[model samples]
Target: MNPTDKNAITESVSCPAVFIAAPASGQGKTTITAALARLLRNQGKVVRVFKTGPDYLDPQVLAQASGQPVDQLDLWMAGETYCRRRLFEAARSADVILVEGAMGIFDGEPSSADLAARFGLPMLIVMDVKGMAQTAAALVSGIANFRDDVSVVGLLANACASARHRELIELALPKDVPLLAALPRDSSLALPERHLGLVQASEVQEDLELRFEAGAKALASEALAEALMRLPPVVFEAPFEDPFVELPSMAGITVGVARDPAFSFVYQANLDLLQQMGAELCYFSPIADSCLPECDALWLPGGYPELYASSLAGNRSMKAALLGFFAADKPILAECGGLLYCLETLTDYNDQTHEMLGLLPGEGAMRGRRGCQGMQTADLPEGPVRAHAHHRSISQGTPEPITHGRRQRHPAPGEPIYRARRLTASYLHLFFPNNPTAVARLFSPEPQLQTCDQSDSRSLSDAVE
Candidate 1:
């Protein structure tokens, strides 16, 4: 596996491959994915990254690991045609493509297993072997047998205590399947964590190569490469033929987007979609830069802006930009983290209140314990908005006066999640297709974007700074 060999068929050809995953959620998928990308890069192989579900943070980390922007792979969330085209387009340029899984192998609607199967990408199964030995073999055997579309290429056992532990697991799998690598129990390899999942890659810029290099050295054993050689190659799907989304004429309109490490929760697709709609996206650091992007609309998506509340308070320029931007009465859309940033002040984990954009009339602070409440939805006076609560901090800012929506298909009460004056801010992010009118009406300058209609003239907000 000489990484530098340019003519290596599998190495040179942009063949698509996936990390088919999960024995469960708490497995070391994220850590291993990052390590693999770094290791492969060390081998001089070009790598591109993709995550299985509707994840925002991990893709950021993976983008850093792969040295290329990461994209999501869920068919429904990203649109099936979009995912197919992105996968192949990335593969055409990359030497090897790594798509990480979510939850256990078969968790979530359109599970990681389904994504791998749908794209015909080979799978690598990651099993956390913390408490078991020979039983680890039976664990993977059952998972491999559970799904027919998935092919377990190799098993990387995480948290194995010692070489003896690794040997014990290997001996158990000789007749069953190939055991690729065994990762030692090293807490240093684990990243920090809070109410949300693992702290994002942007939060920490330390020398990660130390841990990833060691993990790659340990995992890159002859047995692992041998296992990989045995797995049959995957046939890639052809490039999709969806008409390229037309780029809207940007004549001279600037779209202000909330940025900075504190407010970097926007999706690239949303930005791309806006660009196609004829607006130039401008970025302003909500944590550092004092001025907002001299653009029309402001998009504040979800992120952990509260985690760095003290610094956000110290930075006066961002606050001034936000206040001024809102004073101009341009259209504004805020999601979870952005919603918190739009508040009058954001109290950090330490209970100290820091001033924010002040677009909305409320103050929010951090809370604890009640984390990962699955999904949520809110039925406002306009229509039903869909979302989920994936934060550790709770706040008492503005309250919703309408119906609450649950994650399930059927409707329920008390699920309402967002409300603001001519604005909608919720922890739940809708697909836009679900409620395009509500989204468009929020941007309509008809003096009453607050009023939603089945056929309201959807127009861009006049960029205000």
Candidate 2:
């Protein structure tokens, strides 16, 4: 059958979609999902994978495995319309859609089960059966039966010890819920991790390719990868109207985006939205670049800045360029690790203090294992934009915040939104598509912002020297 035309989409489209979920976190969901995607991709199929929540790392891995651009589908952060539209667009061309669930199946407020039910996608529960046998079947059975709205179609047993282990799980499962596949316990299939989560895919691309090939080869002999091709396609309807169609135009605006090992936690959707609104994105590296690109504004997304503190601090010319940008009152939006880079000082895990951009009067340091992560709305002076905070670092002695992020559930505020001159820095990473107008306002230059106190402006000038 011919694929649907991109420009001529009707009310709805259909494609086989699977929600790859787990009983809980660390069930090797990323490994299984990436491997499954790779398996199908190797068979000359178009696989579009999406991470279910505000995740950066998993999408990176999945995107590389599937050889397709991956997106994040969240009911709250991106909204139901965005999710539906994304699915519809994918269905137009993709052979199959795979959404890797976050944390657990029934984990968050709008849980993986909630999203699965909302879209009527079949669920494939992936469980690591290394230490257990029949109990795996019990857990899968319970999860399958727990919600009437969600349809549990099959199960993939990860890290099964032997044929005997696979037989034990298969025999215990219900007749309707068959064992799709049993991936062996192979150390070669394991992805590396850091303090945050899985290390960035770029850092381990060559090894990842080998792992993907190995994983695909592993799943090729199983029923799970083949079953994906035969699953019934779910109908995805397009939104009646594009809510952001009338977003403020960012014509003539060139935003310098920091894209490097230290600041790579950017959502593909955010970049897409910026271009859609007529803004040109110029990518530069804080860790490598000696000067800023000639642009109207700047955006620093989150990543492992703590890991590359020395490199960022050592780039004196780049630091001077940043100070000049700040002194000129150019707009800059920094999130999470970006927030850290703008601080006066940053202490690494080794307790080594490095001088930062000093765009804000603060010091950032790692908090060991403790971290803050949750969905919130950043109450920016431009407008409220939906965002989330996930970081293991903290800032001290920062200027007073202009506003605070409103928590998704609690009445109290979440992360502090600090505004230093034209810089809107925070630990919260804003989802641009959630409020394109607000995001446009953020990147657009404001003349009133030039009225920053004389002392602060002088300090920025002094730092430039």
Candidate 3:
């Protein structure tokens, strides 16, 4: 079924919505949001979950809690119209919409408070009140009063020491604001994290469901339940017309996408847009699969390849298939971790070197520092594309770059872009829906096949073997 079909008949929807925000990062915003989603789901409420930034990991946990795919709601990266459409779509079938905010309440150019104010959704502040008493209330008060348009509905104290600690915070809060819940300090309640952020939900094996249940139990206090019930209903009116641009068709093309532990950082909307543009998508795992599926184009998304470098390095058949795919000059788009896989070698954080596909002229090193991050725009051959870059690894080599990428804030030296034959690789993960036609052209087969030999039947086989 096409994802675009569901949005054809637009209608007004009234769903209670709230943003789970925090004073800063590591203040239990994601934890509380996941817990609330699970608690609401257990209560027979249909919950729609969203992450308020260009985050990939947190949404996985949120999706697990809500039993629905969690979409991103970003003001700049995804645009306002896309966010409104997603909110309306979720509200159509959900009783509540829970959005997990990123970093702090007012950190980035378009913060969580910005989104809340735009949608008129109330904000529930999650403050880590550990090692502080009445000061926590001051922080919440400042966030609430800083923005006249945004409303702070309630406050939740995280990592509190004792009943006295919770009482102190509650007493310090303004009379108009209420203390919704107080979560005691518990190490087990915290999710595992690495340099990037929380470990992906897919990597967490065994007792996953039990972990989410424990998280819900940690936050599902009597006060929280009551506070959730007291939230005002939200009425969302449909726009005068559809907000999405009509996508052109690519009916005769197939795009094979890599999906596994090493390469799973794809945006759902990007995939949906590709499908809407009339491309058939096939998913294959590089870690387990022996060969790639036959297709006109291939996309390798970014993920935690360093964590599973050994397994990926050992996949000889898959490596050969990728090399052959590049040799055949079929269009392939790789980003970040995917770019690492295309390199000659990858050195993990442990300083262990592993062989890679060697399709691109570069070697990647997992330096202990973030290589680059933030929103960027690349001047591609087709056009300018908006993308995000977040990785801790650096590629060392000089390949002929197809374009230069400039970050939105710091337009320093442009980012490196490597293009070998029909392959385009970089650390930037392009949000395909932003320019569907350009993305479609990047994956289109007609341009690549114009130079191919018609007698090479093996290039069109179902699998390498």
Question: Sorted by lDDT, highest first, which candidate order results?
Answer: 2, 3, 1
Q: What overall lDDT, based on C-alpha atoms, would model 2 receive against the true structure?
A: 0.87
Give the true-structure RMSD of model 1.
6.7
- Candidate number with greatest lDDT: 2
Winning model by TM-score: 2
Question: Where is model 3 poorest over a 10-residue stretch in terms of lDDT?
Answer: 456-465
Question: Distance (Å) between predicted and true CA of 207, model 3?
Answer: 3.3
List candidate 1 segments past 4 Å from native.
1-16, 174-176, 222-231, 239-252, 314-317, 355-358, 372-389, 397-410, 413-421, 430-465
**How do the residues 1-465 of candidate 3 rate in per-residue lDDT, one tens digit apiece?**
122444443556788888889989999888788878888888899999999888888888788878999998887777776677778778889989988888899889888889888888889999898899899999888888998998998898888899998898889999877888888888777777888888888777344567677777876654575576678877675443332435656798999999998998888888887887789999999999999997999999999888888999999999989888889989999998999999999999999999988988878999886567888875566555677889898888858786678777885846778788888899998887666656767898755222223222111001100
Question: Candidate 1, residues 285-351: lDDT per residue as tens digits?
Answer: 6667756666666777778788777777777877776666566777677777877776778887877
- Model 2: per-residue Cα lDDT over 1-465, one tens digit each: 112344333577888889999999999999989998999999899999999999999999999999999999998888776787788889989999999999889999999999999999999999998889999999999999999999999999998999999999999999888999888889999898888999899999999999999998888888577787688889987654532235557899999999999999999988887886789999999999999999999999999999999999999999999999999999999999999999999999999999999999999999897899999988666667788999998899998898899999999889999988788999999988876656777888873322232222111001100
Q: Work out the TM-score per prediction.
A: 0.82, 0.93, 0.92
Each model's C-alpha lDDT?
A: 0.65, 0.87, 0.80
The TM-score between candidate 2 and the true structure equals: 0.93
